[model samples]
Target chain A: MKLAYYPGCVSRSTGKEMDVSTRIVCAALGIALQELEDWNCCGATHVPSELVSVGLAARNLAQTDLPIMTSCSICYSNLRSAALTMEDPQVRAKVNAVLTKKYSGAQIRHALDVILEVLEKNDELITVPLKDLKVAPYYGCLLTRPRGGIDQPEFPTILEKLIKTLAAEPLDFRLKTFCCGGPIFMPQEQAAEDIAFLILKEAKKAGAEVIVTVCPLCHLMLDAKQKALEQRYGEKIGIPVLYVTQLVGIALGLNPDELGLEMNAVSPMPVVEKVYEKMAEEA
Target chain B: MAADEEFKQEVLRLAGPEVLTCIQCGTCSASCPTAHLMKPSIRRLVKHCLEGKKEEALRNETIWLCTSCQLCTVRCPRGIRPKAVVTALKELAEREKIKGKDQAYEELFQRQIKDYGRIAEILLSGEFMFVFPQGALQSMELGLEMAPKGKIKLAVEKIRGRDEVRRIMEELGKG
Candidate 1:
C-alpha cells in the first residue's frame, strides 16, 4: 500500500493543509506514502519550455518504481502528460539526455483514486458518517480532464460517489466540472474571480452546506479568494470549502489539527463543529 | 495569407493536427469559462488561424487568458485540444516576445524553476505583482489576508538537486 507521494508546489506552500490531510488520511487507511525524495516542480504549464515541464515531471517520475500519487490536479495532469510525452522513445531519449536518472515513464494516480479505492473496499473506515451533510462536489475543470481517464471528463461522478460513501449527501452540482480559473489567477485576475464566482454561486444555489474540492488550486479559488469574490460581487456566499481529504479525515474521526483544518483560509470550522455536533447528536 | 498558412502549419505541428478538424461549432467558446473575457473567443481563435489571420490567432491575448481547464478539449465534437492550440499559440507569442502580464508571469515562473526547481508562491507572485501593476493592488490585499491565517509564508524552499534543474533549464533554453 506504499505510494510515491508528489506534493506539488501549492500543496507544499499555499495549500500546506492539503499535504497534511492527505498524509494523515492515507496513513489512517494503512497506505504508506513515501514522498519522492528531492522532487522538482511539475512545471504546471507555466514554464515556457514544454521539455522543461515534461523533464521536471519526468525527473520525479524516475524517482519511483511505485505508482505516483499527487493531490494537485495540475501536477497530476502534468505528470501524466509527461508520461504520455515520454511514450515516444525519441522524446524519452531527448529528455533523458539531460537527466541525472533516466525516466521512461511511470504510472501516476490521484489521491482521490487511492482514498476512493480504500473506502470502497471497506466502509468502516468512515468513522464519522457525515450524516445528511449536503456537499457540492467541485471537480473544478482539471480533475477529470485532458481526455481518457478514470472518470467521465464532463460529468464526473467520482466526487459525488466519494461524498455519498462518507454518509454525506452530494448535491447535484451542475457546475462540478467547471473551471476555477486557477491557471489565470494572476494574468486574468478579474476573469478568474468571475469564473470562480460562477461555480460558487452555483454551489450555493444548489443548497450545498459545504463545497468539497479535489485540487488545491480549486480550493485556492473557491476557499482562499472566496472573501474577495463576495466583496466584489456583493454577495454572502460563505459556504465552507474543504479539501476532499479534509472531509475524509473528518469522517475517519481524525483530529482537526492533524488534518490542518485550521490552516484553511475560509475556516472550515463550521464543518468541523458540525462533525462534533453530529457526533454529539448520535451519542 | 501565405505567412498565416505557415503560422497555422507551425501550430498544427505544436498542438497536433486534430485542431484542424475543428468545425467552428463554437462549442469551445461556449464551454470556455473565460471566453467572454477573451477578445477573440477560442472558436474565433480557431477560425482566425484556419482563415490565416496570424496576429489574431497568436497575439490577441486570448491564448494567455486560457486557464487550461481543458473543458473545451473534452467537449469538442471534433476532439480538438483547444487548450493545446491556445498553448501552442501562447508559445508562438512568447517566441515573438509579445510583452504583457502573461509573459511577465511566465518569466517569473521560469526564474523559480531555475532557482529552486519549484515555484515559491510568495517570490514568484510577489515579483509578478511588483512588475505588473494592473491587478497587483487587489491581489496584494488578498496576500495580506492570507498572511495571518498561516495559509501562506514568505520562505522559498530550495530542492536538493537545484543544480540539476538549472542544468535541464539551461539545456532547454533554446525553446
Candidate 2:
C-alpha cells in the first residue's frame, strides 16, 4: 500500500519522531508513504477562519493527482474540510475559478482517513499481541468535527478499532475527543496548560499508561507540557503521549527508538519496559 | 458608525443565523478547554457577537486562542457553536491585521502549516531558533535528547511521494 503523505510543520519540528516512526512502521507493513513534494501547510485552524476560500484554496491546490495524507490532526481537519468543500459543485466551481485565476490545480486528502483505510486493508500486520497494553486513544478536535465525513463527529471509533487491532485495550476516557489546547498555547498559556492538565489527569485516572494521538500539535501540547503543568498544578500527571504510528511500530516488533518513543516529554520507556517484561514472562 | 454596525451584522449573519438564540447556558464555555483560560468566557464572546460588539470581540486575545475543538457545539443546548463564533471573529481580526501580542506565534504556526503538509519536529525546532534566537540553545538540547537513535538516516533521505508533495505545496502557494 502507498499513500501521498503530508508531514505538517509539527512533524518536521518537535514531532520529527512521529515522521520517523511513521515511515518505519509503514515500511514494515509494506505500506509506502510518499511525502508530498513541496507540500505547503494546511493553514491548520487559522487559514480556514480568516479566508475560508483562500485557506481551502491553498490546501486544494497543494493536493496532486493522488490522495494526500497528513499526520497532524489540524492538517487532517483543514485538508479534509477543503476536500469536502471542493467536492461541492458550486463550491468547487468557485474554488476552481479562483484557482485558475490564481495558479495551477492542486488536490489533497485527509491523512487520518488515508491511514485508517490502510490499517483496514492490512489488519494482519499487527503480529505482536498487545493484550497487556492499556492505552488511551485521543482523537483531539480536528479529526472529528464540523459535522461531516467518515469518522463520527462527537465520538470516533476509528482509533479505538486500530488499538483493538493491535491487541491493546482502549481505555474509555471522557476527554478522548476533547481539545488538547493546541492553537491557544501561545496566547493563552495558562488556559492551554489547564486544558492539557485536565486531559492528562483524566487519562491517568482512567488507567491509560499511554495516550495515543494522530495530531502532532495535540501530542506536543498534551505530552511535552506535562512538566510545566506539574509545576503549576503541583501534581505529577505523567501519562506518555504516543503518536498512533509509534504504537503501530511497537506492534510490528520494531525497536522503541525506531518509533521515536524517546521524544515524548513523559517517557514511554516504563511502559515499553513493562511490555518487554511481559513478553519475557510469557516466553 | 453605520459601517461598523454593518460589519457587526455581517459577522452575525455569517455565523449562520443562529447568533440570536444563544441561551447563555455556558455549556459552550464549560465544554471549551480554552475557555477555562480565557479572560472573558467564550459564552460571553458569543453574547458580544449577538450584541453587535464586533470591534471588542475581534480585539480580544481569546479570539485567537481557540483550537477549533467542537466540544462547545456538541454541548450547546441552543447550538451556539462557540468555536465557529470564535473562528468568525478571528477572520475579522486577520482582515484588519489586529493580531494580539502573540501574533508572531500565530505566524509561526501558519508557517508550519504552509511548509510541511504536516508538522515536522526538526523543522519546527529550526523555526523556533529562527524566530526566537534565545530559544536556539534550548531547542538544540531538546533536539539532541529527542533525536531518534539510528533513525536519523531515514528522515534525511527522501521518501516516495516527496516530490509530488512539494509540487502540491507550491501549487497551493501560487494559487
Candidate 1, residue B124: lDDT = 76
Best by DockQ: 1
> How would you class the docking of model 2?
acceptable
How well does each candidate superpose onto the true structure, as a TM-score? 0.96, 0.80
Model 1 chain B scores worst on lDDT over the 10 consecutive residues at B166-175
TM-score of 2: 0.80
lDDT of 1 by residue, B1-175 (tens): 4557788887887778887888889998998888787888889988887777888787777888888888888888997888878877777887898888888898889888889887888777778877787778767766876777686777888898998898887785454
DockQ of each: 0.69, 0.30
lDDT of each: 0.85, 0.67
Across A96-199, the per-residue lDDT of candidate 2 in tens digits comes to 54342232444454544555567678777665667669999898887777667547778789888888877789999888987887776544556677777889
lDDT per residue as tens, model 2, B1-175 = 2236666676775565786788888887777666655757888888777777776677776776677777777677877667768777765666678744455555565555444434444654465556556546544544454454331222432334434334443443332
Lowest summed lDDT over 10 consecutive residues: which window, candidate 2 chain A?
A98-107
Judge the docking of candidate 1 as incorrect, acceptable, medium or high.
Answer: medium
Candidate 1, A10-81: lDDT as tens digits: 875788889999999999999999989899888886865576777888889998799999988888888888
For every candidate in turn, the CA RMSD to the true structure comes to 1.7, 5.1
Candidate 1 off by > 4 Å: B173-175
